[model samples]
Target: MGKDTDIDLMLRFGQGDETAFRSLYMTYRKKIINYCYRFFFDLGTAEELSQEVFMRVYKAGSRYRPEAEFSTWLFKIATHLCLNELRKKRYKNWFVSLDSEEGSVANQLADPSPEILAVMEGRERKKKITSAIRALPGKQRAAVLLREYHGFSYKEIAFQLGQSESSVKALIFRGRDHLKQTLCGEFGEGL
Candidate 1:
């Protein structure tokens, strides 16, 4: 048998086809999960966020118009949810622990007895850059992630973010400037 097309699956699901919803869910689950992970830096939270994102998709399916590409629309939904999550965390003053998200800085620094101090300093500098990106305003962070991490065009990001193209560009530029200043501070003199 052949696979159903995206439009067909969406149409069927809109008409209350549970199987179509299941099919769509299975197809986009991983992408949504990874997208959320980019924001939350935790697999368990990302998984939960992905499920919620899919639930929103199912609820909004009937009202969805094909005016935009399904992939773009799906990402818009995911980005909005992740941005909202960040806002909530900000209001609560909660810090996202990126400790387990990557290799330990400790482990890298531990065996630094032989290697030049500059290489280990570079690793620390990278961490500062990552943290500075995280410290950006939610929209700015989203702008950076969409453009740099996901390779989205300015037009596409502005559309997804519901902002003017100029505004999106400004956000990315300001975000990058902030990261640069932050790294400069961390590495001293000529970063």
Candidate 2:
């Protein structure tokens, strides 16, 4: 089963197959959540937003059209929700934790080993990358994430973003340039 199967399932759900909706939900639940997580860097918010996406899908079932792939449509909804949330909150700062279960403060204190230092360094790099991405203008961030992280083609991203393909290309190019400048400044190396 592939994209066509998704369309069939959506059409079936539209026609009142509860099981079809369930199947679609189960299939996309984690993907949507992770996508939202990347946008907000918060698992709880991501889960909540993903629920809203499915809710919209459920409510719009009857009107759902196969104008695009189901995943593309689903992501469009997710993107809008995420962008709206950003505007509503206007979070000025976000702190990403550098600790993991294995790298707890107590453990680090007990053994300030080279391996632990490496792990900490890796987390720092990730933090810098995440911060750089978050600093991008919303549309550019969305375009970059959709193209680089989500493996979306320019056409698909344009469709999801309601922009022209050339515009999507420009957004991604500018986004990448911004990220490169920011990350290179921090790391003193190419991204």
For residues 48-165, write the lDDT of model 1, one tens digit per residue. 8888888988897788666565666677888898888887744345454434323465466655554555665566555556566666778888888888877778888888899999
User: For residues 44-145, what per-residue lDDT tens digits would candidate 2 score against the true structure?
Assistant: 889899999999999998899999999999999999998888887556555444344444663648667788778876877787787778788778988998
- Collision pairs in model 2: none
Supply every candidate's count of residue pairs whose N, Cα or C atoms clash at under 3 angstroms. Answer: 0, 0
The candidate scoring highest on lDDT is 2
The residue ranges of model 1 lying beyond 4 angstroms of the native Cα positions read: 1-5, 16-20, 89-129, 184-191
- Candidate 2's C-alpha runs over 4 A off are 92-111
Positional deviation of 133 in candidate 2, in angstroms? 1.1
TM, every model: 0.70, 0.88
Q: Look at candidate 2 and tell me the lDDT of residue 191.
A: 64
